[model samples]
Target: MTQISINGVQRQVDADPDTPLLWVLRDELQLTGTKYGCGAGLCGACTVHIDGQATRSCLTPVSAVGARKVTTIEAVDQGQSARVGQAVQAAWVKLDVAQCGYCQSGQIMSAVTLLSRNRKPTDADIDAAMGGNICRCATYVRIRAAIHEAAKALA
Candidate 1:
């Protein structure tokens, strides 16, 4: 059994050390907010915050998490004291950024991470930060607008 701190709670997950953190979260912990798109980590569908940084849970092993705090989409709005995540979530809703809604969680995670560090990101910066997250609906235009809106709200 390995202990992982998830969403401000410590959980004891019983699985192989090599098991992906995504399965550990969804299967063992029942935190299904993190979706599995391409297990190769190229799709960014399994993005989560590990120690306040965006991390791909599908490619990350359970043993690698150690004492790091993992934050999923379910807790992103409530986890941050600065309300950056909440602002991003609000912008996403306001802009109707989700089409199929399958990849929105990952997109929001990446956006929150981006805005947390850079209060005002340029279009290029937004593209660079969000490039990994793929939305089959191709909502890139709205996603970009929401990011800008979130930045404005944060400002």
Candidate 2:
């Protein structure tokens, strides 16, 4: 059993160290909020925060996590990231950014990371920060809007 820290809690996950964190989170820990999209890490559906940085869980092996803290969509609005997470979630909901909703969690995660670092991101900044996250529903317009609104709410 390997000990992994998840969402402010330490969990003993019985799995191979080489297993991708996406599988460990979904299958082992049942933290299905972090979805598996492109297994090759091309898609951002598996995005989660590792030590406050947005990372693709599909590409991150469980062993690589070590002592780093992992934050999934389930408890994003908690801990030190609370303020930004809540603002981003509220903006997402208020702006109705979800269509299919499969990629929203990753999008929100990326947005939260972006907002946490840059409180007021411009259109270019938003595009740059959210470049990795792809929304199949073509909700890019709304996603951008929500980021802007979230930044405003934070300000």
Candidate 3:
């Protein structure tokens, strides 16, 4: 059993070291908030924060996680990211950002990471930070607006 810290808790996950963290989170740990998009990491649906930096869980081997704390969408509003997470969620809701709602979790995760770092990201900065997360519903405009609103709330 390999011990992994997730959402501020330490738990031993019984799985192959080579198993992707995405499967570990979804299958082993049942933390299904992190969706499995393109397993090649092209799509960011499996995005999660590893030690405060957004990481692609689908491409990340469980063994590589080590001591990093993994924060999924399920607990994004609990720890260090609580304020930012709340703001992002509120902005997403107020802006009606989700259409299909399949990719919103990853989008929100990336947005939280961007806001946590920059706090005043411009369009270019938001684009640069969120480029990896893909929203298939073509909600790019609302996504950008929601990001801005979340930033304002955080400010």
Candidate 4:
């Protein structure tokens, strides 16, 4: 059994060590906010935070996350990333960023992590952090603009 803290709650997950965390969150905890994109860790769709660092939940195992904070988008926007999500969501609304909205969760997760790390990120910095996140609707321009707008809001 692997012990994990998810969204401030502690739970013991009994599963294979190699079982992907995405399944654990969705199946066991029923937190569906964290999506499953590529399942290969290439896409950022399964992004979640482990100890405040953005990590791909699809490629991560339950055993690997022992005794660490596993925050999904459900809690992210509600607890820790509320203000950040607000700023980003406001910018997203202003910029009309969502098209299909399938990938927005991952995009927002990456953006929030970036904003948390660098309060003021240049275009290149944003690009570097957001490069792996693929938006099928191709909302890169609006996403970038929203990040800048969120930074402005933070400032």
Each prediction's number of clashing residue pairs? 0, 0, 0, 0
Using alpha carbons, what is the TM-score of model 1? 0.98
| TM-score of every model versus the real structure | 0.98, 0.99, 0.98, 0.93
lDDT of each: 0.93, 0.95, 0.94, 0.88
Give the per-residue lDDT digits (tens) of candidate 2, residues 21-52.
99999998899999989988777999999999
Which portions of model 1 miss their true places by more than 4 Å? none
* Per-residue lDDT value at 83 in model 3: 97
Show the colliding residue pairs in model 2. Answer: none
Error of 3 at 87 (Å): 0.3
Cα shift from native, residue 1, model 3 (Å): 0.8
Return the candidate ranking by TM-score, descending: 2, 3, 1, 4
Q: Is candidate 2 or candidate 4 better by lDDT?
A: 2
Lowest lDDT sum, 10 consecutive residues, model 2, at 34-43
Candidate 2: count of backbone clashes, pairs at least 3 residues apart or interchain: 0
Put down candidate 1 lDDT per residue, 1-155, tens digits, no spaces.
Answer: 99999999988999999999999999988899999999999988899999889999999999999999999998998766349899999999999999999999999999999999999999999999999999999999999999999999999
lDDT of 4: 0.88
Which candidate comes out best when scored by lDDT? 2
Candidate 4 collision pairs: none
